[model samples]
Target: MFVAEAAGLDAIAATGTLRVPRTIAHGISGEQGYLVLEYLELGSRGKADLLGERLAALHRCTADQFGFAGDNFIGTTLQPNARTNDWVGFWRRHRLGFQLRLAARNGYGGRLQSLGEQLLGALPAFFAGYSPQPSLLHGDLWSGNHGFLADGTPAIFDPAAYYGDRECDLAMTELFGGFPESFYAAYRAIWPLDPGYATRRDLYNLYHILNHANLFSGGYTTQAEQMMQKLLIAHS
Candidate 1:
């Protein structure tokens, strides 16, 4: 696990725009995996604009397909990265379908499952006019995962990195509240988001909510239902 995470950081830094902690070492000892990274003193706050611009720059790095070259983790959950050309197909099979199947195995069913099916069937409608290209993503860009270093350099870490719709990273930033308007503005200035991103943002976020429901409490299931309802209503 630690080796995978360290490799993810290395992958992000390879983009040449973002700053990530250098991976010093990684190995598994006994039942535990260990990774050694360069120690960084994070400042009290991050420069949101810089991070956003840098994030946009990172997203500019594109991929030929809608998954990573290899699989990685998202909050310790197994995230598969089998490659596919179709964007919607990739999300349906990998993101939404994968999570829903896991939830069913974990004994979450009924309305959540029903609504999830309906939403999954309508996934194509969500991207009726928008054709997304594969781009490098932090995979988990929540507020807690990024900040400025002691030297005031913008640094982002703890990534579940992959090649997918850049909007996935953008949507997760909104899930938590640490990013500033300047950050968003900077991102837009670099790569303007397509129209309908507002509603599709909920669709993108549902992946996380569903994952949360599987990983934690039933509250996330409720939230996922609400997100599904919103999408259905919008389509209707």
Candidate 2:
């Protein structure tokens, strides 16, 4: 976990688009593992607009394929990042399909699996003309994962870094509540989202919701099912 985390932090920092706590070192000590990082005093009162602009810049960092050098975790669950040139296939196999299989193994089946399979089959329709470059992503981006340093520079941390659709990062930001309105506006000012983004946002965010359901095993299951049903209906 610590090793993957250090790699992820280094990946984001390499972009130089936004601030991340510098990764100092990571290794196992005795029975425990540790990742040492340069500390920063974070605060919510920092510039939301700046956060948005910088985040947009971060999304500009791109790659040829959709994945990372290796797998990592999304809050403890192993997140597979096998590189692929096909974005839709990558999401279906690595992101959504992987989670659904895990959910079944954890005894969440029946309606959930039925709906998830349908959604997976329908995934191609969501991409239509939208071929996305594999942008560097803060794969676990949510409101809690971002804040500002004492100097008011926007800083994002605890990344599940990968090369995927930039919309994955943007979608996750809106999943758990959301960032401020200024954040969205500023981001659009830098690089406007696709016209189909409203629909695909849910599709991208489903990955995280499914991850949450797998990790916590509570209302998130019902939540993920509802989200899948809603998505199927919308696409249908």
**How many clashes in each candidate?**
0, 0
Q: What CA RMSD would candidate 1 show?
A: 1.2
Per-model RMSD to reference: 1.2, 0.8
- Worst 10-residue stretch by lDDT in candidate 2? 143-152
lDDT of 1 by residue, 20-131 (tens): 9999989878988889999888874767788888898898898888888778888867888889999898899899899999989988899888988998899999898898
The parts of candidate 1 lying over 4 Å away from their true place are none
Residue 2 error for model 1, in Å? 1.9
**lDDT per residue as tens, model 2, 78-193:** 99999999999999999999999999999999999999999999999999999999889999989899888877889999989999998888998998899889999999999999
**Candidate 2, number of clashes:** 0
TM-score, prediction 1: 0.96
Flag clash pairs in model 1. none
- For lDDT, the strongest prediction is 2
